[model samples]
Target chain A: MYSKEHKDYLKKIKLHNLLVKISQIFILVFFLVIWQFLASTERINTFIFSSPFKVFETIISLYQNDDLIHHIWVTVYETLVGFGLGCLIGITIASILWANKFLFKVFDPYLTILNSLPKVALGPIIIIWGGANATSIIIMALLISVIITIISVHQGFTNTDENKIRLMKSLGANKWQIFSKLVFPSNIGTIMSAVKVNISMSLIGVIMGEFLTSKAGIGHLIMYGSQVFNLNLIITGVFILCIVASIMYYGVVLLEKKINSKWD
Target chain B: MSVLKIKDLRKTYHTKKDEILAVDNFSFELNEGEFVAIVGPSGCGKSTILQMICGLDKKSSGEIEVPLNIKIGFMPQGDSLFEWRNVLKNCLLGLELTNNVTKENKEYVLNLLKTYGLKDFIHAHPNNLSGGMRQRVSLIRTLATKPDILLLDEPFSALDYQSRLAVSDDVYKIIKKEKKSAIMVTHDISEAISMANKVIVLSNRPCTIKNIYNIELENKSTPINNRKDKKFAYYYDLIWKDIDYHV
Candidate 1:
């Protein structure tokens, strides 16, 4: 049961949400249509610019050759492996650093230097060390994502309420009890946000790794396409990458929602 | 009978530059079922004394004596409730930390919640509670540990004025009804006068006790009611002057 005004208000909110979704789809379709029209009519150079239809044809051709799924899977597998291991290593290192202030202080400058350095510059070393395979790609991804995760998660742990720590200490909580019951649980939101950032970083690192070395991922397809002057293949590779990245990012968002729901 | 005693307590905080003496020669006694308030100007070493007593902060030099069997509970300035936990779980946090979550302990906490009018919200999170309700829940959380002496550090300072008065009244009643000893630190002269059985006025930075007043209101009931007692104004004036108000 509801009042007339309340029903009207609910209707208005639903209408607004629908309009927003429609506008988003409209913008994407409009861009694709304009791009397709320009390329088909030769107003733009289709060979270089690569029309939407050409990209679609390229995707179909790759699917027919049974290369599309394999390429997408390779990139996704590398990203997930690197992301998962990166988060685990980051949390462990952060906990150790939090437990020993002297160790944290000793390594502070080194972490800062590593974080600020462009990780891509180390691609040659990583390829040499891990030997130019999926291993190298995953290693590169870990290098890119692990440092930032450690910094952010450790910051979150230290930023827990001082009074809460005092209360725990007054209650005769030992160090392990304080960390487990207070510090760790309170920083779940921080850790989740770090995960969100880590996924994107991992993707970037995987793509860069594939560009330098690897034969079977989307990044490798783009590299091969550019070297052979196949504009359609390059555009198709980028489109697939976009789809994969969005799916992975949304997956993390859903996980975060699930975790927060338990708290509230 | 005195349950706890402090003698010649001192604290010195060291920074990169120099050390600052926070509390010097601070000594006090808390009896079995007495409510004492320590009031002073802001930034005084009043809270430092409570911290030392509860073993949250180490004293540079001091003697704090209590029977080994006596347990102490602490309530910080804000409610300090873990928002991720529901009210009942929050109340159980101290017990959980101490690894004493027995069936009788759970039932005792439940009884406290029911007695304090929080039975309906036993499963609700802290954010869902009002300011007054949050303070009550915080007190019950302290009470849940079954401590003989409660150390309260500016417990109501986080609330707005309206809720501060009401929650202080509520907390005073709960403390009295539970028959537990308490030592509260605050900067409010009137709050000390109305609620405390004994008020210790502290001096500035290197805190020392200026004077201790044993309140004798005509009808010293709950805090709000005590404020209306004939002698409340007289004690308030005396303690107000005793504090070394820097500003």
Candidate 2:
């Protein structure tokens, strides 16, 4: 009887999976169809609000001109650099803070105030310190991502199971041993979630920096297109940004799966 | 030789409001290879005694003496297994902490994991295991430290009734096999009688030792088996009344 019920439950899950995939595709096609129809019929001005077809044509033209890869590479490189540096510096500082209670308390109020401050307001200052090159873009992204990482990963490190720490002490584990064995491993979930949030936060910073200064990248393309009244280019840049962001987010998910499989 | 001794042990918690006495003038001596169970009314600071004994918490006054270089392993109320680690790695935590992760210690832990029913679950995460299995993994982790004495604080109470019985028996067998002195605190009267060689009963808050019983079972068997020795129920009632039960 249990086996039969289990079989029926598995069949229900398979059906649910098939229906979900079908609905996803159906929604995308339905949206594109309505968008293309409205633009082609001139119900919406194709000049200001470009159609899906024009956006696709714009992307293909950019590809033919070979600027598409360059623009994408520029943004991807900036985001990757900023992400790596932000996470590294954030975690190191957090570890140092965790190792010293006095240092953490001294910095606690300042960190809270800085985290609440709008980082975009510091974009002009970043240009002054780092210049209008890739360095400044990376700095802007770091400003966006690092504070969140510090707050989150530090929270994870401090919020480990106290009982387990006590157990370690009973077994004669010292401070460093307790931190590495108990504090670090127990916060794996928190760190992964922080990684997921950091990716998007860094992406936003890069795009905002590109808007402020860059002559290339998807963000620059959209800004330039708006100035030149090129609606197709603006729409196309936005489309590529969405796709790129999705891919990067999925990459973090895949990394999460790999790490989970390795550790857990 | 006595592995552990506590004389006039007292623990006072000083909060922002005022100081509260948790455990007051409690004392006991544990011989090598002895199994002692501490039973008291709920919220009577029984676990406080184990914490003081294991040096996890500070005592207000009195002495908790142990032989120098002697290790103490403590299993807390919850399973307290490291959730990120699989059973094997979790079992190795104590050894890893002390830099005692030698080949011999690893082999001993592996043997313990296999000898118990956790052979198939050696690769499984603690979240994936049943409560009984998690507690067994926890016990193995403690035993891996090769502590001269073990302090268990309500270790099996988190489990359901059936798993609690099975786990208590499993734990009893493992403690016996390891030949380590054990001091366990549990609220269950029958559990105290079934597993412990001696039982220590405690009064309500400002806890102090009220009475100690020398448990005797004729068959000398597992915890489940000892329950059938007819002396179990008699000792159970005696300790139950010893506790400050208001109802």
Candidate 3:
């Protein structure tokens, strides 16, 4: 049923995509082999660099001790909580700002200042106020993510097509009706993008909070390992963190795709 | 009977640096089932008059006398159909906004889609529609509200040359068939001559009515066919010369 030229073009595209995938895996494997080879040959210090095999061994030992799952769970839980609260508060505040132009104008400079200031620098103060607990860690994430969400989502709300707004007003729609029917629904993609950025920001804030005053978590594990000079534990913690971050980011991406498709 | 009348309508826009008078002493009237096209130079406040009529923009000073029973429907420049909504939902937007979506209203909107040859694409999104089809859908959306007077603000300007002609023909037929009075704002003089019963010309910035021409065509059926009328070029030249075009 297919034409020959079209079939050939499709095959060429598939081959190119397969090559890219293979190259990605090859690079990872090459890096692992070179690092392992150098450490074994004593060209690099294995104790400091912590080769992949040693990191894997450390993970398995930690798993046997039942500490691995608990630490991972702690960090994941904090990140999830922080992310959820940040999105809710941010969107609520954005809606409020969109509703009242005066409030938006008054808060404009304050929002900019809060957004640009380093949220990590507030970790010590957050610990002092909320104490060394999970709540403080969630608050830290909320602080980091909420301001950005408000700024981006409000921008989206205000950037709705002027003609659409005029159409709505021409239809005799009230302010609340316009916001619900036109502004909010049209900005779904914008809100989803803000959610994506917010998820990563929450994770960063959670890790920083963990570093300041956490008793358990991947951040604490890495901090404790560094203090004890256990490079293997530190490397293992970093590896687990990378995996967790990737999973969360991709989860958001999948959700964004689902929502965009529904809208389309 | 006159359905709507505006007397000495005025609009002034204020910015930080200066105040600009957009419309000055603009007065017109719409008889029942009449099509009036307002044509002027670019930025000559043609659209501001339509906006004030629809109450989208507040008039600085004027008397707009519309019978309390008459509803106003407005079609903006582009289709402005919501991407998330299908053709059916987009058409129902006006009724939905007015909280008048009764079963009869839904049936009325559905019938309009079917009558206008949009039955096959009722469930299709706006992005999938052709430019001409989108404009037709936009007109159907405006007609769905059953307004007595329609305000069209450069409705065909967004389409390409070919589709703009086709869509204008489509829109003219729809308005005439529905027996609704309309005030359409356009920069295209040929479009004004062909589609409207009367063409109103205005002067540049702080615009006022320059001249009004009652277009006399030998045989005027649709916008496309009317373009071939012998007198079409005569009216076009008159309106073209009426607008003050300068650098």
List-wise, what DockQ does each model earn?
0.87, 0.70, 0.87
Instruction: Give one digit per residue, the lDDT tens place, for model 1 in A160-250.
Output: 9999999888878899988999999999999999999999999999999999999799999999999999999999999999999999999
| lDDT (10s digit) by residue, model 2, range A83-202 | 888888988888889889899999999999889999999999899888888889999999899998999999989887778888888778898888887887777788888888888989
Q: RMSD of candidate 1 to the true fold? A: 1.2
Off by over 4 Å in 3: none
How many clashes in each candidate?
0, 0, 0
Ranking by TM-score: 3, 1, 2
In candidate 1, how many Å is residue A113 off?
A: 0.7
Candidate 1 — which residues are off by over 4 angstroms?
none
- Residue-pair clash count for candidate 2: 0
lDDT by residue for model 2 over B15-41, one digit each (tens)?
Answer: 999999999888889999999999999
lDDT of 1 by residue, B135-167 (tens): 998899899998999999999989999899999
Window of ten residues with lowest summed lDDT in model 3 chain A: A255-264
Each candidate's TM vs. the true structure? 0.98, 0.92, 0.99
CAPRI-style grade of the A/B interface in model 3: high
